[model samples]
Target: MNRRGLWSVRWRSAVVWVWCSFCLLTLASLTLRYIVLYIHPDHDTHRERWCPPEPVESDECYSWRPVLLPHATCGCTRRILIRHTCSEDLSPKMWDGQANSTCDPDGSVRGPQQLVMSISTPFLTPKRLATLSYTITQVNELYRGWVLRVYTRVNKHSLPSLCSLVCAHPNLDVCDITAMSETANTVHHAAWRWGVVGDPLVSTWALRYLHHALLPRDAHALTQFINSNKCWHLMKDHPTHSHSVLGSGLLAGKTSWGLSELTGIRKRILLTRHVVEEEQVFRDMVTPVIGRDVMTHDSLTCYTSAGAVPFPSRRSPGQWVGMPIPTLTNSPQNQNKSHKNATDIMPPQLKVFSVKYNSKVNTTDGFQIIKNQADNDDVNEMEREHINRKNGIPRCPHSCRPPLHPNWDYC
Candidate 1:
């Protein structure tokens, strides 16, 4: 072969090798790119999935199942001890005497016979719900702590105003006043309180709890929100009660706290007053504790002038939230028997928690007189002061003002 022919073959071989290398590199780059993008997945589309420690098999398929974690904060788990009003004044003369007469109230109060949804997903599972329940309880604790601080600082006459200041603004730091009032109302009128005198401490505790559950957990975040009276950067319409409903079902397995037998002496008496006649005296005694508004209606009465009557309005057949108060150590084991009511698989839950006391955040509102305070400083200045007060830090660097330019021009 000629020299030129030999050189041409060598060059062509070199060119082919280069082309092959380029194609391989391009393919690898594309593969790496796909792996980087697709392997772990993105936050926007991922759903939370908890794999059970052990596998569960049924029918043809098998999957891991989550172990039931006992309700942590509350008392025992075997029987969910609930408070209720069993009897009250049944005299026809009283406002609610007509309806306070039935144990079941035609089932409307029990809510739908079962949980409409399954409790399997991360949203509905025990752990997540327990955490949320804990958070709610913690918030209540913080509110109490704050109230104690305010109460200590001021006298009785000044309490309401200070409470108003602490709870006044519906800003980012605090929960909505309307919601707080509603919770206070609920606690005051709980079945346990029907015929009993009201206790201010219970109201205060409930107020703190419901509000704290809806507010931020971080102290700084809470402080910023409270000072501003709004959810962090939320709009005007953002304070609706639905915020509580958002994760409630997932955590508590249901939204409403089912009002059952009204077991407590006060509540039972109040509830009983509705079904049986001549329980009138009991109702009167209980009325003050639950507040006058609650006493007017019969605990067993299904319907009211307001609308169609539902279940007992209090008791319902829904999954109870959290474990019973005391840790379920050696408590009777609830082995599921075949004949057991399928519905009974999930029992009523009463969640109890150790109170966390944060010395900031107050939550008393409604019936509060609004007042104008002197705006001696701008919002900016107030914000700075707030930061300074919350955390002992200065806004600007210390002792560092800009130096003056001596010569703007040749003097």
Candidate 2:
């Protein structure tokens, strides 16, 4: 072949090699992208799957499973708990005749049964359905012996504003309010989620849980969502996954110390490390203090999973969040005797814990208003117990709900 022909062939070969190299690089990049997505599924799609509707109008949230976690923070678990916890005044000074003093007149006070729809937002939780539902079929069975009603646009939002609207219109019943909005079709549509889904099971269950469960659990959910008032960057293990480093937040609040009380915990160690070093950090800092008590360890060490970004993790160190209180020993024999003095408290929770004290059990429960008193206070406690029983009230089982972040799986 001539020199010119040979040079032409070489040039063609070089072009082909460059093209093949580009394609291979593109394929590799795509593969790496897929792997990253698989390891850390984009929570947005998960949020979209779980929250199909707008966050505020999600018919309450789908991910809010009926399962309650052991470390729930408030008496706000199911809708019943929301009604019982959010409505009924927890104050000892609240007179017996006026049980609904703190509750919205148009809301929790008006009906013992309620159904709630909540928006599931990544940053915020629906806090006030004070109601719940399951897959019950019959509509009548669901709302049996309960009043099903739609009341307010303001109620569609939080009660703080609608509550004020209700005071002026005390005579306006839910039917009246719902009817008043009927002609204003758009108004009703936004607030009217009743029978929204054609599915009988979903619709009837929503109705039943709204009323029978006392309140929609969403109400309780909102009550517990104080972990953060507004959505901000989460600096901990995405609130859903279990980890060994936990911390309180400007909004991601702490869990109950009661679980520690019940389980008999003493020393709790919370550690923070670069998100890149999550496993190593847990092994090095937290494991020893927690010993092999897996449950306790997981619950206490929740904040460590902040993503590996250097800037964010620096601000949020893993923390020891539970109250500094005495806990029972691991041994059954010394268990009760170990935490004999639980009276000492850190703060905040001490304000309202007075509601559960029993004279017989000596719950050692304290109140912010009435800390320590003489034997006469025991008489007062007995009187309070009788009043509570008379009212068919029980001490709230949940004052808080479990974490709602996509990472934590109460299910």
Candidate 3:
């Protein structure tokens, strides 16, 4: 053994020790980051883009919910690769920029991170919610969708004052209010509107004359809106591809769901300012005749003269028993001309009927208007006593009344 050999061995030992120390430190750093990140983890390092399971088709609503994450988490600040159809990667302006972009099968949706209303990083507070609510009222008439309330929550301990303030917010349902304050690293929520209405029923007014008819001319329009359809979709016959339990129930007046089943569904119809915003032919005639407030309210009264209106075959599934229902579809583009002409759109059969509406509830039990063939269509002849009552008409402003003018009936 020589001095040179001894020196080489000592140097090799020192290098190995240094390398081991560096590797141990690096491993520790990564572990800590993993623990800190579970919520809104770094997009670059963690593949936080967990493609959640799509919501199953519910019996109540045509729409489904795909849970984005397990809990409220901050929006991923980094660009996330989204490879799914009908889902945007928490990013905005990705697909909107493409004029004719369809949901591509193999293609992916990508862009800037989608920013949502959260406590931090574009923080939105309780004060903002109230301000937003107030502002909504001002422009509510101008736009159809106005949210009177918002539901959200935050870590009470992280910002107790902000948490308390938000929790106490009126019209807000702040879940998990008592939990310890979470660090600002996490986000809470945002809610989407579903058109479901409570246990509801509609009363149809029956009529026989062609001289004066309310809904006979606009029955299709009323039915369209009542079925949670857009006016334009009603114009020529394009169904929005969405369905509602309330609308379904009203069609048969039998499938009416209990509160539990009804609440499960949200989309009853687009709760726009006007029930029939499209089908312009009914424009000036129907709206002014029937107050907008009454038509759009959660409940509605339908005065059908002649017991039947020219309802789109699709709109009324079981209204006519044993008769094949027509699938009356309209043009999507007709939405453009929806507000155009009122008188020109009515089908002649509708001439024998009319419709009026009331928001007030007439009865807890629903109503159905059956065709009375033997008697005269005049109000007096079609009295409740004279009519054949198979299914009792539901409560209404004028239930079991003859198919006559609203003025004559004072309904």
Give the TM-score of each candidate.
Answer: 0.17, 0.21, 0.18
Q: Which numbered prediction scores highest in TM-score against the true structure?
A: 2
lDDT of 3 by residue, 224-334 (tens): 333441111112111110132112111211112223323332122222233232123133322232222122211113332212222321111101111112221234443
The lowest-lDDT stretch of 10 consecutive residues in candidate 3 is 202-211
Q: After superposition, how far is residue 368 of candidate 3 from its true place, in Å?
A: 20
Judged by TM-score relative to the true structure, which candidate is superior, 2 or 3? Answer: 2
lDDT of 2 by residue, 223-244 (tens): 2232222211122212322332
Predict model 1's lDDT versus the native.
Answer: 0.24
lDDT of each: 0.24, 0.26, 0.26
In the range 1-411, model 1's lDDT, one tens digit per residue, is 545653787888998999999999999998886686577533212222221111233443322122112222111122111112224222222222232211112111211211111011111122222322334233333332221110011234433332332332111021111222232223222121122112111111111121122222222222322333111111111112223311111111111111231223334333432223213433343222222111111111112211111111111111111112222222224321221221222222222111111222244331111121112212254554564444322222211111231211100
User: What is the lDDT for 251 in model 3?
Assistant: 21
TM-score of 2: 0.21
Which stretches in model 1 have alpha-carbon errors above 4 Å?
A: 1-127, 138-213, 216-411
Ranking by TM-score: 2, 3, 1
What is the alpha-carbon lDDT of model 3 when measured against the actual structure?
0.26
